[model samples]
Target: MQMHKNRPKNEKHSRTVMIRILTCIRPHTALVALSLLLSVITVVLTLYIPILTGHGVDQIIGKENVDFKELSAVIITILACIAVTSVCQWFMNHINNKITYRVVKDLRICAFNRLQVLPLSYVDSHSSGDLISRVITDIDQFSDGLLLGFTQLFTGVITIVGTILFMLSINPYITLVVVVLSPLSFLIANFISKRTFAMFKKQSEARGELTGFTNEMLGGIKVVQAFGHQDEAQEQFEEINRRLSGYSMRATFFSSITNPATRFMYSVIYAGVAIAGCFAVVRGMLTVGQLSSFLSYTSQYTKPFNDITGVITEFQNSLASAARVFELIDQPSIAEDKAGAVRLQNPEGHVTMEHVSFSYVPEVPLIENLNLEAGCGQRIAIVGPTGCGKTTLINLLMRFYDVNSGIITVDGQNITDITRHSLRAAYGMVLQETWLKAASIRDNIAYGRPNASEDDIIRAAKEAHAHSFIMRMPDGYDTVIAEGGSNLSQGQKQLLCIARVMLCLPPMLILDEATSSIDTMTEIRIQKAFEKMMEGRTSFVVAHRLSTIKSADMILVMDKGHIIEQGVHEELLKKGGFYARLYNSQFSAV
Candidate 1:
């Protein structure tokens, strides 16, 4: 996989970021509004308890005489409000969690769908591990921030605003002191928040790197052991782990500082409010009940500030995840089918490449103005050294990558003018690496045709000469193979792949070194099966074994992306050219 060396850094808190996030929530606006309403009720109930306590104190001091019935009603009303608020809080949390889950689900689906439409070049340039991290880990981080941090921030803001308004109505002098301390608290929070944001971004990036490293290591463990590089791999893992630890520590330390600084600032503000309240009480500027109420409001005002700071820290972490996700979503896709692109219907297997020029990268052409033609049902064999553009030829024929210059056609229709889905659906491919999922042998065979019946799967398997061996397994066709068919032999896996393509029954077929891994004996046994499978289909083979393609209708011997010779086996042998030399080398060994 190609590595992206320069991932962009998210340095500023842009209004655009907030706007994008809000756009994701557009579908869930109703739920968000309901949650906001519940948050309001929670804030109101939270502030009322302190006021009710102050009233009870006044009643006990005989300053505000209350009858038993009125006192009982007030107490019951306060308690009832608290209970309702608790219920509303639960309801809001449920809605928040639900919305977050749905949003993440939608985002993941969108990302995956976009991946499908993206070009093979794009996928080749991005690591599988990094892409997976963006889809899974980053989206989850966004969910966490939305569900926990956003909820707290909303409730805190409402509480702070409501408390300030009530405190001013009770006693203006005390409210003024509380208001002055707000900026100091904010300044401290702002400083810590910036540091936390930077650390958190690093921490998230480190996590993705670690995940990619671990995945690469585990996937190639056999290679590591065979090469005796286990220690090297271990050291690499240790380095990544240490880096992750350093970033985590920095993020945690900054996150930890925010709360304490907030608490200290709150303490200083409280001391000042207390001193001022005492003087006002002595001066008869405030009543005991009013002073007590004012003090409660002042302390509660800091609750919102603390809550906002905490939420801000969490939002910073979540933004890191969002940045990764957005990067993927914003990536340019391969050119799509044009406005009037038509689907190929019942395509003839005739294929032509005219003056084709192509490159995986600019300035390094893999194939240059190459021309070739294959009639319907013709078996074409391509022979070349490694990296001589044989596979690149197949990639272009399959439309996995478009040519830089020139045209490829199916039945006289330009492939570029056809829908990608329709173009690919016309061909069946058996790659060198036969990838089998963790599924039953029957299911694996039916993968090309999900709705195919049991009999159809059995027929395809039988045609590929896989049924006899599959029947010998403990569960026969029902036997489940490990991922990548680890439980099966290489020949067995190749046979399954052949069976899958046979099930698809496309008019055109590609065999990309498909039988290279199978033993000589298995190859001999399956040669007839392959011949039968190739019958009446336009077939293209990238040959590793010269004998396998000796019977091909046309053999194209290639060197350095150019066709050096093209003829039937006997005709090519008579020419004494590249094909003749290749045939002599393989048969000379025999």
Candidate 2:
């Protein structure tokens, strides 16, 4: 039931998100500027047509001397302007779409790159599904809302201002009513918008939860099927789906109320305009043509308010998404590399933990001032009961988590003084849970050194005893592996992982229960490969199999995060310590 910790929260709404978003569009600023100019022209052209119509109506009704040719010219000019506006609108739409796509592309890349630079702890504490939702869903929402809302809001404001100014010039009294009603429109918009924003925030959170559930369920489908828990999973999924549906409905319902409520207020204002205008026309306070123009202007004025209100709603929704996006972007990054931090060059891979104390969380210390050291070219085996901090030691050595107290050094260089990238690059790791991408076997094997040639890949694979099996497959090295190497046997998968680590050819190697799941024959094959790979390299192996570490230069038996015994396998056995007891227990049973 652990939730993702990296989930975004709305802290404060600043122009910062928009500013950052606009920076990505700076390359397309020319196109954007042109689009904005065209949009303005379109609004102007749209407003002028009503004035032309009013003039034509006056000519026909009041003068009773319709200059048909002049009227035709006016109508044609209006039509021409309409055509121009349409063309401009089309171009604007194209530019906006292009800018939006580019911005989103940049945002995605930046977000992904930032994710890479973040520490392992960040990834460990977050769910892949929730992060995926932020990158895919939240960004998509921002893109959709931004493009539409920017254009509509700009044009709407211009139209509203232009119409109001024209109306005031013609009939100040009627304009007064519109000016009074505008504030009321804004008030209603603000009220509805607050509700919409809340609903949208809830909707976004629900979506992340739903996505996380999908990822977890799909990733563990094999386990679910093995346990015959499909129905139970379905029920759990259905419950999540129902909750998502309810939240979505609430958001939609609140959003739906905005348009109708705005329209209802506009309707009242429209009725008032009609009645007031009619009275003015009858009393000769306003001419028929003037009244007609005023009515047209009133409609134009209302349109922008309507448009603004709609944009406000969209803005609210986007703010919800932006809150999530910014939340991730603003997360306190892992300790950054300091200026002038020295690089560990030609590392000897002689690692030492000096009174290192650490914890994943504050309450529980996984490694308590644990002291250990591995000389260059020495093979160290760490054996312990499960959760006795064996793997945690490796994690610390790899600098995945900084120690709460004390220091870890590699080749006399404090790990904290070196860049994480540089420090990690010096080590090769083969984890117990081998992770293979859905790619060709050759690609998987050569993943550690992407530029490695076919010869290099084959050499590495051959050393791990994986080359023969790979060649015997349907497509040989080109055969595609399934996710997590599901198509291969566990032993074969482990061998491939070893081959990948071999390709890296680092001076330090970590093998975390790498041979635990393999058969005896495969284990023997890999054990030789590991011994060969560990040659002239500082190596740490965490294993339950006592035989694997019998030849290790040093063996440390750990219990409850403390190293209780240390020596060569025979030396520890002669000492009759914890290591001896564990070794005897297994051999005694056999």
Candidate 3:
């Protein structure tokens, strides 16, 4: 009952995806029209071959009275038609290939562009591997399906229609027999197509899950090995693999049934046509040559039905994959900047948050009614227990996630009133998780300030205490870093990240465990460099180490999303509150 009720919606969605796919082809209309013309020419010329064969046979009318001259003319015409048909078919296929690949290229670009504008929340909720599968694997499947449709589908339809017309002209009674049996083949194909589509859809989803799970496990394989969870991971992988295998088998099994079932009906149609034509010939209503032509038409008509049924499996799979790709392209993107929004210029670094409230999940409140103020050039440090919203606060200030209520302002102007690009441009940030591209050391340091000269890049590297080690490498500044910086040590990667921030030297700074990965001696040098850079900039430092922020102008101790304590480090210790307890515990542990 549920399946029957949902069928219309499923069909509607399939039609919508198909329409979108066609729109991508609209740009190449001239080529498509050419392909169509070729299909019509090809089908018409091929259909003429059967009539010529009948004429050639009629000319043979008993061996002694045979008209060899007429027979030779008919045979020559048939051969000429065959050659022309082959050429047109080749051109048609070439055009189809061109159109199919171009559409696939357009789809990939659209999906990738949509990914850039989509909100971070969407990315966070979906697996990276799953998204990759949609953009790459799904698009490839759609390409194959579309190419098959173009190459065979158009020619097949033309053949079917042309055969019916030719048969009617030859003998209406025999054409009736062929037409009646045609619906039986269609019914069989329709029933199987529905089942195959459902199965193929599930199979595509399972394939995505398998890709995601494999990516996740491989990315964290070191951790899995460290924790000795290889066995458990293997078990999980096998489970997903089995599910994918089952879905693929069922889909293939159902699609395979389509060809045989439809072929049986087509065979019945051919037999009916033959029996009817034989009777017509005996009644002197049709010539033996005409009966021969009618039989050839019957075969010609049924040939397309067989070819089309064979292509149904691929077409169904293509539609299923297109639905997935369109789903990604149709996702809601992040809201655009408000109209008349002003860009922050020469910001004074004065930041304030008043009665701000936010939570990742609505039911679970993380931060509520938070109020704080930082004066110009003040170095404010935030310390909190794990899951106490330390990072969430940074996210709010960066506008990566907006607050639920209240206002956050920079330079006495609401941040929301400021363009996100300009607001973010005013701040330099360094997080514990350092990211480096597959580029030279010089390029990595100059990422934030891409136009920085060679001298400036070197100066920034020296300030972050990374110049000495960088020079030791074979290529020095030109040394290329591997993806994810796996070729560099943890401390070296962190130093390069710090060098990036130093080069930018924005008006405000947000350092979240910025020096967590460095050695003690290098960290001391980096801190001095940080102090020099933060001299006139408002800096917000989030740290777990109690000693790093001792010289901070104000230290905020947060718990359960609220600022439970705020003062200079010395004053906070003297007050014997949450700050003192957290500080003392860390000192004692060391």
Candidate models: Cα lDDT each: 0.85, 0.83, 0.91
Positional deviation of residue 428's Cα in model 2 after best superposition, in angstroms: 0.8
TM-score of 3: 0.95
Give the per-residue lDDT of model 1 (tens digit) for 278-393: 99989999778777887888788887888888888888788778877887887878887988989999987899999998989897767887999999999999998888899999
Q: Judged by lDDT against the true structure, how good is candidate 3?
A: 0.91
Better of 1 and 3 by lDDT: 3
Best by lDDT: 3
What lDDT score goes with residue 456 in model 1?
Answer: 89
- Local lDDT at 419 for model 2: 86
Q: What is the lDDT of residue 53 in candidate 1?
A: 67
Give the 10-residue window scoring lowest on summed lDDT in candidate 1.
1-10
Reference-based lDDT, residue 534, model 1: 83
lDDT of 2 by residue, 25-140 (tens): 78887877787787788888887887787777766853567878878877898899889989988887887788778877887887777777677888888888888888889988
Candidates ranked by TM-score: 3, 1, 2
**What does the lDDT read for residue 230 in candidate 1?**
89
RMSD of each: 3.4, 3.8, 2.0
